[model samples]
Target: MRCETRLYNALNDRMRRSHGVAASQYEFLRYLRDHPDTRVGDLAAFFAIGVGATSKGMDRLEGRGLVRRVPDPADRRSSLLELTDTGTQLVHEADETFGAIGALIQTALDPARLHDAAQTLRQLLTALEHDRIGTPAG
Candidate 1:
């Protein structure tokens, strides 16, 4: 958890300095870039956040002209998200900044140790996804 917090803080600081966008905002933009026309409810589910919170974030993104919401064709009550040209450019910049940060971190670690660590983390994630651990007992 501490490691996760540290990484999140570092990414947030870098994103603010380089892109003028908060890390959370960048995340939302990135998702929109990849999944154009996605619904707010889908985003909320993907992020494990509430619909209200997701809507609020979308509001901020819309205010910045980074994202636009169109009435969903299939669901009139909800909107589909799409990234603007400026938002797409910002996502590219954010990707570069993230790559640089990743390279900086990689330089400080031994390749073999880093590979092992990555493998272990992947295993842990897979186990969690499969509900191999942390499920409440009946």
Candidate 2:
């Protein structure tokens, strides 16, 4: 828990300083970039955040011109999110920032140990997702 908190704080701080984006926002943008035309509900589910919070976050991103929502053709009530040119540029910058931060962190760890730890964390995350442990209930 302590390690997770420290890492989260460090990453968030670095992202804020380097990209002018909070860690959550960076994460949202990253996912959106990878999965274009995703729905708000899908994003909320992916992030394990509430629908309302996801909507507000999208609103903020939209207001900043980082994200744009187009009416979903099949679902008129919902919209599909897509990154704008500015958003794409921001995501690229954030990627660079994250790479630098990751390098800094890796420098302090043994390569083998870091790899092992990352593998373990990935397994855990996969298990959690498979079991829907943190997913919100309908």
Candidate 3:
């Protein structure tokens, strides 16, 4: 937990300083970029966050002109989200920022060790998600 927190803080601080985006917001934006027209509820479910909180976050992004919400034709009560051109561009640049971090890590640590750690983390995440498949989300 300590290592995770440190990594998160460092990464988020760098991302925000370099691109005006926090790590959490970047994750949300990247998801929207890949899944255009996704509903706020669907995003909440995917991220295991509250729908209300997700909607509020979306509102902020909309206010910043990085995203826009449109009425869902099939479901009038719900809105579908799409990334604006600026959001798309930011995501593209953020990819490079993330890649640069990976490069820095590889330079500081053995690339083979980093790959092994990444693979182990992936396996752990998969198992964790699989275990929660039939469980209720907070």
Number of the top lDDT candidate: 2
Output the TM-score of candidate 1.
Answer: 0.84
| Model 3 C-alpha RMSD to native | 2.2
TM-score for each model: 0.84, 0.93, 0.86
The local distance difference test score of model 3 is 0.86
Ranking by TM-score: 2, 3, 1
In the range 5-110, model 3's lDDT, one tens digit per residue, is 8777877988899999888888899999999789988888788788888889999989999999999999899789999999999989998877776776788779
Candidate 3: segments with Cα more than 4 A from true spot: 133-138
- In candidate 2, stretches whose alpha carbon ends up further than 4 angstroms from where it belongs are none
Q: What ranges in model 1 sit over 4 Å off?
A: 129-138
Model 2 steric clash pairs: none
Q: Candidate 2 — worst ten consecutive residues by lDDT sum?
A: 96-105
Tens-digit lDDT track for model 2 on 1-138?
997788778889989998888989999999999997799999999998889899999999999999999999988998999999999999998898778767877998899999998899999999999999989874
Which of candidates 2 and 3 reaches a greater TM-score?
Answer: 2
Residue range 59-78, candidate 1, lDDT tens digits = 99899999998989998987
lDDT of 1: 0.85
